[model samples]
Target: MNAELVEQYRLLHERRPDYGSGASHVERIAAIIERRGVRSVLDFGCGKGALVERLRARFPEVVVDGYDPAIRGRERIPLERYQMGYEMVIANDVLEHLDAEGYGEDLLEMGRLEPRWLFFNISCRPAVNVLPNGVNCHTLVRRPEWWREVLLACFPGFIEHGSEWNERSKGWMLAMTRPLELEGRRVAIVGNAPQAMGNREDVDGFDCVVRFNNFVVGDGYEAVGTRTDVLAIPACNRAVITPRLKRFTEGVSYVLDLATAGCVQAKANHGKIRQLLPHATIV
Candidate 1:
């Protein structure tokens, strides 16, 4: 957030009380609260804190807090702590007003708070009001696709539950859930530890089984079951790993190469791996 831009917004909020109001997203956010059973909600970039009062009135059981750099009380919370344990975080009609350079940083900061869900309402078109400096209020107006890329980069593995472009507001409303595809399922991430020596029945009973790099299962079958639904392996040294992989290719459907960070050899290794494990998908 730019200091000068924040000062301009602060002045605007004082002059026009309805300038940063987030009443438009009240119903949308309230629906999430009711559906997800969210105990607490932190309204990121809340203007005038109007949404705070409205949400509390609607869902008295849910704790709602607002944070805005331009707002006096709200400004202090974001600066003091990054690990706010809110179940849901909402930013409505707020990203457009911020500087383009600082947008990623702001999104990353919001992610650091670690909310279970993130709700974004971004205006892709120009704002109705102008700034104190004789400029459009919507400083960074980009298409919905551009905004989606930014949000996805910050919150990886978060599945998009709902998304739609609202012609009425000339913006996009997106609801994303963190830790994708794990809800209401029995998932067992079996590790290659000595403690996992006598739990084959319990391990294989899970709906999904995830195992890490180079897990053992021949003589050690009793310890770590024969089920390898999802195998996560390091991308390095495929030549050494191929022999072991050939031995345990059965029931292994997906192989996640985790050490592929700037390693050019990892992409080349994927082809060799595909031939070795014909049944499994190499990622």
Candidate 2:
């Protein structure tokens, strides 16, 4: 933990003492733990130890611990009390509070814990709570995509569960889980061009067959192949890709480029495709 960053939070907490009420948030988190069969959890920035108490009360069999630098003496237990390598590590409403310089360090510390699953509930908007200087408690408010980018930098292989809206709390929650590796796996990339017309047998011979944007199989199943292990789509080709995706690509691994794969007019396509493909890994 950075001493300067800790001091900053300590001062912020002194100014806005009641800024850490996350009881409703705890309920949602607990539900996830139960559904996912998570036996152990470490609440990284457990404000006031609210979630820790609730987890123990609701699920006595499960092990839960908390760490909060700001409220450690008063409401939270010290960081040293908890052991590393929890089944899940949660940092609810915490990332947005860090200073610019401390953000990467904080994320690194969370990564060092080496949890199987990591949950982050970050407030992208301004907080209701204000400091003595009249600044919002959320100092590092950013768009969901920006947060995802920062997270990917720290954990590249992890599978992301994109920003999902919580109707109960009216907030967004982001999650990522460590994925099983596929080392030296043979995969055939089948494009939508005419060359892939009669190569079904060769394509299907591989362990997995990957299809490119807006591909068809029903027309020539014998020639084009029926199996689609993965779908690779460019960011700007949404008009041709969106409807096909909804109709066919459930449970399919989608590989998408963040920018225009080939060429597009607009610098940024402010369309529904961006929201639809939120969890896509940037190529």
lDDT of each: 0.75, 0.67
Regions of candidate 2 where Cα sits further than 4 Å from its true position: 1-5, 12-17, 74-83, 165-170, 180-283
Pairs with steric clashes in candidate 1: 197-223
The sequence of per-residue lDDT tens digits that candidate 2 reaches over residues 220-242 is 55576666655656656866786
Error of 1 at 274 (Å): 20
Over 4 Å off in model 1, which ranges?
78-84, 180-283
- Candidate 1 local distance difference test against the native: 0.75
lDDT of 2 at 48: 74
Task: Compose the digit string of candidate 1's lDDT tens values, residues 1-283.
Answer: 8899999988888898767765776777776787557898888888887888899888898878888989887785543345556788898888898887787888877787788889988899998899888889999999999888888888975655568797887889888875324446576777777777756467777766778777787674755667766676665755567577777765454455555545676675555444333334456
TM-scores of all predicted structures: 0.63, 0.58
Could you say which candidate leads in lDDT? 1
Candidate 2 matches the true fold with a TM-score of: 0.58
